[model samples]
Target chain A: MTAGPVLKGAADRVLAAPAAPRRKGHPGAYLRWLLLFAGGLIMVAPLVWMLSASFKFSYELYDLNLIPVEPTLRNYEKVLGDPRFLRWFGNSFLIATIVTMSNLFFDSLVGYTLCKFRFPGRTLIFIAILSTLMIPTEMLVIPWYVMSQKFGWLDSYWGIMFPGMMTAFGTFLMKQFFESVPDDFLEAARIDGLNEFQIWWSVAMPLVRPALAALAIFVFLGNWTAFLWPLIVTNSVEMYTIPVGLKTFAVEQNVDWEMVMTGAAIATLPTLVIFLIFQRFIIRGVVMAGLKG
Target chain B: MADLALHGLTKTFGKTKVLHGIDLAVQDGEFVVFVGPSGCGKSTTLRIIAGLEDATAGTVEIGGRVVNNLEPKDRDIAMVFQNYALYPHMTVRKNIGFGLRTSRLSRAEKAARIAEVAGVLGMTDLLDRRPSQLSGGQRQRVAIGRAMVRDPKVFLFDEPLSNLDAQLRTQMRLEIKKLHKQVGTTIIFVTHDQVEAMTLADRIVIMKDGVIQQVGTPSEVFNAPANVFVARFIGAPAMNLLPGSWREGGVALDMGGQIALPGRQLADGTRVDLGIRPTDLAISADGAGQITGAITLVEPLGAESMLYIDAGGVEIIAACPGRTAPDPGQQIRLSADPEALHLFDATTGEALR
Candidate 1:
């Protein structure tokens, strides 16, 4: 008997020959490209605006104009010529550098301890340290301020740098990263006659460079852009960081819009440069930490 | 090379006991394999030997010296992990030379030793590549190479081949055997796979529930198991057990059948288990056999066929050669060779003869 109509119909669909399109489809493809272009523009508009404002003259800022009417180097000149601006920039650079390096070294120290060593109260210590991450900085602000005053640290660089140096989040991030590493690696190194310090320094540290870099970027960015803490502690203009100094420039009477934007632009540059350099490591570390946690 | 011994070894984690008074000895240049199911303390025993774990109450001796307080590095033993823990950041050459470099060895000597190990492991071409760049087998080879560079007195392998595919595992198993022959270092291997234990071990130690059930040569363990746990564990298509009792002149099966016994003189009314290997079961066409069975399932494996038969109220497996694909639901008579049969006391699970 011949095959049924249903089976024959399925066979015909399965074995159908290729056919040319009845209508042109280029418009749909172009429309998709247009939507993508619009999305890109929307995401990049703020950055373009910031760059444009950084170059505009003081009179051109209030015109609500996208393009600068008079793009001059006068704002940059004013910002660079101010001695306070240079001092603030130097202070910010030094603090961020110190905090970043200390965090990288010290957090890994504690991270490796928590990860490998089986000391008494290890879990308790880890939980205590990790709990610090949940406490908001704002909640601790008053107590920290009073403590800094008691230490006679207000208006000093230590008041700002010391508190920002060691962070619970950095230690937590590093501990999680170190835990993902196989225990055998450490045991193998130990069997190689390497001491505990040597294992942490040579083997564990090298393997965790990516995580360290990500943490460095995070700490540096946080320290560089820190406003509230620095603002509270630094009363003198000499010890002011860029963020605090920028606020001073904006609040002064007859504020130069161009100069303020230049100061803001300068403050944003270091973070941008750091992020651009270590963006891949930053993304990888974030994804790894997310997966591990 | 050196011999090692464990004396009254025992371990406990909090309230739970893991290893219960285990004692063993390994001669120099001999390979001992610990085979058991998971949570049987085989890996724990190996770790204790490696000084990676502290035994609760035991003394471990390596090279005739007690190493209970010694660190792993001081124990003079090298271990190859199941995960092949090669340092992912370092190249193969550096990974092999790390231990030497950390010691008092000079730079030149370290390089020479690395080169020698690379040559031995056939890893000269992969020396410049990192661990992440190598395949699983290559990484395992690098791990072995790292252990070789140490030239320790004893080597411990914790299921090193469990991570590889079946084909690669067999090839690596043979390589490890050859390596043992060449190096002549005492080796302690841990694996749950009976095939691996059977193939590579000079002596196999079988364990159950953290206790050493038996230790003997491969043939001894296979031919004469110490207990029912071992008899059931050592062989494939496990030994068949028939419930029976000693009668006046023979053993009577629960199904009202009887097999004539020699003058062994088992106590009357003693409960016993008759054990027989599948290969010992002969197919007979005559109805005069001791047991009759119906073939319920047949698995033809080209070289040999396995028949699952229902006989004497128990299902039994019979291995037959020569492509004999018996049809399902067919009647068959099975009788064990009188000389090949095994007798065991039912209560103690110990061999009767």
Candidate 2:
């Protein structure tokens, strides 16, 4: 007997010839792309406007025009010629560099400890450090101020830089990455006659590059753009980081909008360059840490 | 080359005791394979011997010196990890040379040793490549090369071939045996695959439930299994056991059968299990035999066929010629030579001659 109609129909579909346009059935596909494009443009428009304002005359700041009618180098020249601006730039560079180096060293040490070592209360210690990530920086400012006052560190670089030289999020990120390195390698390293510290430096550290890059970028950016703590702790212009110094454009009577925009624009260059250089590592680190860790 | 010995080795994690007390000895240059199921403490025993894990009680001796308190490097042994454990950032040359970092050898000597190891592994052309660039077998060879480069007194392999595919595993298994012969270092290898243990080991140490059941050469274990566990565990498809009790003339099987005992004897009315391999239980050419059953199923393995027959109350496995594959529901009479049967004390699961 011949096969039923439904079976024959299924067989025909299963054995159909190749090279045919398969299917497309979703609705509003082009509209989704359009809406996404609009959302991205909205997010990027402020930066574009800040760049445009950096090159504009003070009178052109209020308008919605992206390209200034009179784009001039006068504001840039003013920003570059001021020794106060150069000092603020140097302050930001030094503080960010110091904080990044310290965070990379201390956070990785703490992370390797929590990940590999079998010390008692390891999980408790890790939880304690990670719980610090939940504490809002705004809430910790009073205690920090009291401590700084007791240490006579107000208006100094120490008060502004000490609170953020190491972080909990960095330790957590590094621990997540270090867990993927095999325990066998560490045992092998021990048999090879390297001490624990040397093993951490030579064998374990090289395997977690993505986390290092992510942590370095994070620590550098966090310190460079710290406005509230730096503003509260430092009164003099000599110790003001870039973010705190950018606020100095607000004088008592009126604000110099062109100079502020110029400073803010210049302050953003290093972060943008860092992001561009390590874009692959940052994206892959976030993806790997989120999905696997 | 050195002798390795474990004396009264016992391990306990908190209140859970893993290894009760294990004592074993290995001759110099002997390839000893620890074969067991997972959680049988074979890996733990090996780790204790390597000094990676401190024994809770007992002493490990290498070259007749107590090494229980010594560090792994101080104990003069090297291990090939199951995952190969090569540093992903380093080339094969650097990875192999990493073990010599603390050695007092000159740079030229370290280079020569690394090159010699790479030559032995036949991976000299691939020395510059990272582990990520090599195949699974090549990574295994690099691990072995790193172990061999040290020329240590002993080598510990922790299931090093468990990661490869079937065909690659076979190929690597042969190469590892040849490497063992060439170097002649005392190697303690651990694997769960009995075929690997049988083919590669000079002596196989079989373990179960954190205890060694038997230790013998392949022929000894195959010919005379110490107990039921070893009897069933050493061979494929396992040995078939038919429970029976003693009779006046011979051992009367549980269901309505009796097989003559040629030379072995047991007390009357004693309960026992008759252990017979599938190959020894022949399907009789004539229809009549001691045990008559109908073929319930057949497995065609090309070279031989396995028959599952119900010989009264119990179902059993028997083998037949491949080309004469039996059909299901066909009547069959199965029997084994009296000399080929293994009788075990049914209660203790111990062999009875």
Per-residue C-alpha lDDT of model 1 across residues B57-155, encoded as one tens digit per residue: 989999999999999999999999988878876888988888786567788888888999899778999999988788778889999999989999999
Interface RMSD of each: 17.6, 16.5
TM-score of 2: 0.92
Q: For model 1 chain B, where is the 10-residue window of minimal lDDT?
A: B255-264
Candidate 1 docking band: acceptable
Candidate 2's displacement at residue A244, Å, is 1.2
- TM-score for chain A in each prediction: 0.83, 0.88
Poorest 10 consecutive residues of model 1 chain A by lDDT? A1-10
Superposition error at A64 for model 1 (Å): 1.2
In Å, candidate 1's interface RMSD is 17.6
Q: In model 2, which runs have C-alpha deviations exceeding 4 angstroms?
A: A1-42, A252-254
The true-versus-predicted C-alpha distance at residue A13 of model 2, in Å, is: 32
Task: Please write out the lDDT profile of model 2 over residues A118-208, one tens digit for every residue.
Answer: 9899999999999998999999999999999999999987788899878988888888777777789889888777889989999988877
